[model samples]
Target: MKQELLSLILPSRNEAEGLRRLLPELVTLLPDAEIIVVNDGSDDNTLAACTEFPVRVISHPYPKGNGAAVKSGARAANGDVLIFMDADGQHKPEDIPALLEKFKEGYDMVVGARQSGSHAGAHRAVANDVFSRLATWMTGQPVEDLTSGFRVVKANKFRTFLYLLPNGFSYPTTITMSFFRAGFSVAYLPIHTPRRATGKSHIRPTRDGLRFLLIIFKIGTLYSPLKLFLPISLIFFFSGLSYYLFTFVTQHRFTNMSALLLTTSMLVFLIGLISEQITMLIYKDSD
Candidate 1:
């Protein structure tokens, strides 16, 4: 396919300056793209900034989060292909072509994995690495960047998981995991990002960091509960055995702690077994 109907969706909030700068570059790069800017209740001139461009603008009455804006863009997009990128100026417009090119090779989704120097800060880089590692373990595939907000995906496949996405900052993580769990083909392309040119970053290490971690556990269970539960169950079981052995040699009797550990392990194993069954039924229609 030489040409694809591409829709570029930018989810923005209080980013009028960034939009003013980015929209023109995007228009010049992909003249025919159906560019859509989702103004997520910005107090600034976000809506006004988009008026001078050829793109369509959607405005929210109140401040909905990033995830909510993405859902709106996905639902309103008319193209077969959807390209989602932040309007905070961190993502480069030039990377869109590379992502689309990767998508053309028959990938369901292609994420723009940010290079090490591209992260907003060193702490953020380390945190993202940790999240990526955990996601890779959960999916049993190398997940380069789980929370990257820049990527291109087939609209049909991408819309299927809209209901699974939370109206929060972690929509990227949710959609990425949902794709993997549904057996969709996913690929990553390394890209560099410059720091945002306008507005302060909303990412606070103490707040958003915990949110990302919670998403990991929630998505981990959604993917495979046993992968998360089995390890804790084993630890309990082994601890009980070791304690029982020590008690038998020292006091010649089974101790309360040993029995408690064994009982808890059995209960945890049962719970995990039930969760696995439920998870299987939940995703039975994935194929």
Candidate 2:
């Protein structure tokens, strides 16, 4: 086979300094594996810097997004297993073995779960906690980290959801939830990350936080719309019922507000039902 058994994908954007330091070490360690550096429209000499290494560079002409870079790397990779890590060196090269080891135990994907204090900032840490809890409830499985980019996945299985991944930083969230909801085995290995080696983080708390919130909403709608819609429908129904009961007892009449509330409740429930069916049909051919 032309492809190696494993491939390493590093998504980079103006990370020449980190890539220069990282590539040589990765070359020494995983000599046989195919190394792909997806240079996501770096204004710096990221492409030029990678020339000394044997790794492949998938260069984009203009800036797309982190997830877009990842998608490019994934499509270009020719391996049975794919390992994804940051090009900025937040993820450790030494942890690669641990991810591979855990994955060999039959997991479709193995994530490098970030330990306490490994988070980039307090706000992101808290946000990740909330996202993890929500994902755990939705999947009925423990979600140690919902946004860890350090992971090794069976290439075939991962490519199945390529279309679902957005062209943004939220790809990690989408893919993780997709695996859980699709009944694929996933494992997490604890790891600590040092501060980034190079390049400034593009993640702004206000902006990316809102984008991730949108990711959560997309996850709800994509995997199981009913999980999101049913609870909301029930809340509206109960509120409407309470309002109707209060008016019936106090005024001996069904108020227009009560009627509107009750109607809205039923409408939401019907929408949830239809969404659930559509979600099922969409994944019917799923492997």
In model 1, residue pairs whose N, Cα or C atoms come closer than 3 Å (at least 3 residues apart or on different chains), thus clashing, are none
At residue 9, what lDDT does model 2 achieve?
Answer: 97
Alpha-carbon runs more than 4 Å astray in model 2: 1-4
**1-287 per-residue lDDT for model 1 (tens digits):** 56779999999899999998999999999998899999888899898899889999888999789999999999999999999999988899988888988998999999999887784777778767888998899999999998899999999988887887888888888888888888999999999888778888866778777786797677676778888888889999999999999999999999999999999998888888898888777667664
Judging by TM-score against the true structure, name the best candidate: 2
lDDT string, candidate 2, 189-218, tens digits: 999999988889978888776797786777
Model 1, poorest ten-residue lDDT window?
278-287
Candidate 2 at residue 209, lDDT? Answer: 69
- How high is each candidate's TM-score? 0.94, 0.96
Candidate 1, residue 135: lDDT: 87
